[model samples]
Target: MLSKYPGAVFRGALSGAARRAIPASFLSLRIALPLAMAFSLGLSLAVHQEACAQTDDEQTVKAIFDERLTSGEMYYLLEDLCKNIGPRLSGSEGAERAVTWAKEVMEGYGFDRVYLQEVMVPHWERGNPEQVRIVDVEGGMIALNALAIGGSVPTAPAGITAPVVVVHSIEEVEELGREAVEGKIVFYNRAFDQTVIGTGAGYGGAVTQRFAGPSQAAKFGAVGVVIRSVASNFDDAPHTGGLSYLEDVERIPAAALGFQSADRLVEVLEVQPDARLYMHLSSKWHPDALSHNVIGEIRGSERPDEIILVGGHLDSWDVAEGAHDDGAGTVHSIGVLRTFQKLGIRPRHTIRAVLFMNEENGLRGGLKYAEAAKESGEKHLIALESDAGGFSPRGFGASVDDDVLERFRSWLPLFPQNTISYVNKGGGGADIGPLRRETGTPTIGYIPDSQRAFDYHHAPTDVFETVNRRELELGGASIATLIYLIDKYGLRDEKAQ
Candidate 1:
């Protein structure tokens, strides 16, 4: 399937009348004066043309925004992914269905090419509902809403019951030593730092306890680990995310308690001094299974060999629909291609959209794509990712050299002041990080408003209803406009010339 190619450029012609031959003495003076005037006139015309091009860029950006805001299709696409297919953890039936669905949807849009790249992905399942409770509280027994961390080992059939030892950080567990932690449950009670302006920074600051706490506690001979939910709001829903276990340390079960439940546990521990808790998880690890990264593109009219990639992970946690975590990003990437094709805006560089698999539990898809690019000797112009929730646009965070960053900053005027106002340094997506490292492709992370991102990140509440249609469309429009600019004007340092 292909859209009619619109590969035409219009040029303005300037013609002048020829003059009769002159005498040798007068020829030198007449020729010099005309030549000097011609040079000045040429410079003025060049400046005027540059200004006209800049104005066209602004008008084009506005058109893209208008189309997306008024007649966007990403919202419906996200609905199908989040509602019909639901959670798509790698190696599961849902993940496979998502692969096929994405392929067909892109094909329907009539991209020039559509295909899949095979990748073996890690497979793990949350087998059953987790059972965690504060057994020794004054009230009969308080059940704490919790979820087993992805990639964690299952607890004993009968479950674990022991005295709870509270620690704010992994270092605190080290301070307590094996003597205090052995045969006990380590509760990592650190909460999100509300003082941080960016919620993402707060998540980064607190996520270490969830990602490394289990292994660190296990190193000190703890039987189990429990952590406060890495969430922005105080609610009954528990957030689930992947955990990394060191090879040398003993594998132990880990879970995250809802913010309110965590606070309840703290209150009990404060009064009782030595409160016992019970935790039972039914999570299991399966053999790595086959998956694929769905890819589609509208080949560049001029520079087909050089590619500009836009992508997001397709696999989400199995807890609930992954609307914000990445469903927004997946649709955003596809929307870029759809908008370009619908408007007949053939890019100058091959613009490819990738729906990477296995970002939730593992980065297999991203690594595979990068490896393939290197083997084929592919040249990537840039890679952009949208993993943040589908919120109103803010700007982008870039992982590029200062010259490239400056070049990107110059294009900010094309975008509206309310949308995409800044382009900061130091940001890239988990899936695209390998590509940047393997191929040296400059990376950009689409930054939406961070206020409500953590609220649904990795939680059951991250469903389709939480996403606002206008917000999601605006995010996609912002990405499309950026890609259009990058394709139109290459990322070279023009000032050097």
Candidate 2:
């Protein structure tokens, strides 16, 4: 059995003069600055770098990255998907069409196998356009731009016209008490902090309101909820994401305000006390509809029994082409698999690229994949999820045994040439989290330079136009390299190969 250690250590290797030695390409305007910053991050993990034999594995991975950077196919593939089949929200005709598109793609690329796993997903349609009318104290009604947040129930007949109660933080609502919250429209004005170099950090700070504000505010007898769009850009587009209601909490109408509208509303409220608003939404959840998880594979020659899975959700919010949010992720996952075949590199374990369904509104796709893995008693040696926006490769974050983690750390030296430094202990993407739990697999999430992801995340602007070509290919190469390494030398010695 492979030794699995619990103690964690980080080994960050860098010389004092690391800066000057890096080449001009390493000093890319798009990549170098982030790499230099990543270099300073002290990692105390210990690893036997000497033990990482200058093996064929290292050579193959380097070649993979080179190909990805120079001649990667993800660029053109994404063009067709985004320009052709844009905005594939799950259970919608677009999502269903995407499944067929993926199947044809796999076959056209000459994959050994291509298939789909049936997934029944919730279909929540955003009906007619939502209306937000600002009733001024001077008696003039101004219509504000808005959209119903995904998974939110539309307002009733004649809609809700209540005094808008704006709060900067959830704690502010608590401070104001139930007396102030009752029968009012709750507007969560928390914006994504842009100062953080890694925008994911900022998103981490403010996403709570978008995900849970409604149920929490409903507890205070709020009539409706309007969360500031979870975005870093200043625009008039309302972003949408998943929302859940706590058991027994009253379900009220919810929506998101564009950053500009949120700011304007704040300004108007300062001058005109007792600002009122009428919100009219017509969104609802219907019965489950058909969806599928698109699966394609490259069978191994040596140890076919072991499995390495790579994936991205095939669903997006129903606005712009879901390119960056996950369409880029899905294409990159497929791009990794396709690159292996194109490069003529056969693996030692079965490598699968799964395009998961319903990741936007529900986690049903992830849950089902894990459930099948558990019930079938199949061993998931390693699983990689690329739900993060397709940006330049930063490093890999993982949830694995300490010994396995130590082994992963040993491989960092190979990726330094590509400037991917961080390889820390972490969880996989939401779509693969359940699989990690059910199978106890060594799960990994692709970490790109999260510098610009939040600006477009879950928003209409999260389209192909926002996706950087070089960055997308870089991300694909990183994932392909990780997949190659894990598949070749198995994640653990104890796993049957």
Candidate 3:
């Protein structure tokens, strides 16, 4: 069949070879004429095949974007997940409901398979609202906005009241020694670095205080710990994230004060330097609960054994609806599969969508998934995660070699201008990290605009209303396009170890 289009095929071969120009005058006429014709015939067939594949991929990607923009269902699904299911903290009724809803939705979509992978997840509850007050100062008692850190031990019914000792980092606490920190409440007032252009970078710089401050302060006999919220914006709303406790050290209650409240604490300290604080946190940890990693897949027609996975965590902090932290990612995963089915695009490699559980506090779901894959000998060719937020698409970050990265960068021009045009080397996400480490699966993280993500991260402001429909849909489309590309032309030299 290809022999009929000899001219077109020869042109395709010449186009590919043009990248590394070969001289035509090197060959003598008698040998060159016949040999060149034979070589062209063979090369032309291969070239034609390659060009056909590229054309199909281009058209498919365009169709994915069009379908997502015109009839995308992720926005409405997110509305239900956020408004109806609400916050899906691990072990909460909300989480159970979300699991059921996700399973049912995937089944309704008629995926080839839909199931759950059982996992034991930590269960932490915010028993009651937290209380923090600045006292023993010239201004009398002043209340400060606060929220208890996840996985923190509950304070006594009456709570603890002690003199406040402020410090910037854990190093400063060690320098102060036990004499100054003992029997006092340690206040970590390190603010997010404003100079960092990426809000995630700024969050990383200041998040240690929230995650490890309590246990570090406890080493010096501190009764409690209060950290300034790890947020970019200066607002009265406190951001709450998970805290870790050292087994060797005493577990003490910890909470995050809102940006404005931290500022007030600093002001009071400057004037009196002997301020006392009374803090009450009712957060508690229950026994580990059984959860499941919700999974759905569209089996590939050609290479069913090889898998491509995309996912996000289903759990969120208990404070808000979790519309962005991961609610966007959850629906985004589903949207990818939905778009494939809607476009009737049968993939070459099985595409699986996993909604991980307990990513906010524990990585049990991710760990369990990796373990199950290893035990079952399931092969994952590539994994991608979308946990950044439902914001404008900004390409993907990959934990791949230089050659693979270059191949991905070459496709940047295929994407729409100003949408998903960048590719960088980095870890994919918390949920996919284990898979990469355990199986050497190439991982990709969907990168989105980060300027506004931290504003509502782990706070009550991360609600359904904060997400934009266009931005969220665009993200879904971008993910689908990437998945389509991978399905068409699998990542460079991917092999399951």
Name the candidate that leads on lDDT.
Answer: 1
lDDT of 3 by residue, 6-74 (tens): 222345555666424446665687777776776677677777776675566668878888888787589
Q: What's model 1's lDDT at 195? A: 93
lDDT of each: 0.89, 0.80, 0.88
Off by over 4 Å in 3: 1-12, 15-55, 493-497
- 237: Cα error in model 3, Å: 0.9
Q: Give model 3's TM-score versus the native structure.
A: 0.91
Q: Cα RMSD (Å) between model 2 and the true structure? A: 11.6
**lDDT of candidate 3?**
0.88
Ranking 2 against 3 by lDDT, winner: 3
> What is the per-residue lDDT of model 1 for residues 43-92, given as tens digits with 9 covering 90 to 100?
56754655566667767888889888888589999999999999999999
lDDT of 1: 0.89
Models 1 onward score TM values of 0.91, 0.86, 0.91
Better of 1 and 2 by TM-score: 1
Q: Sort the predicted structures by lDDT, highest score first.
A: 1, 3, 2
RMSD of each: 5.4, 11.6, 4.4
Return the TM-score for candidate 1, rounded to 2 decimals.
0.91
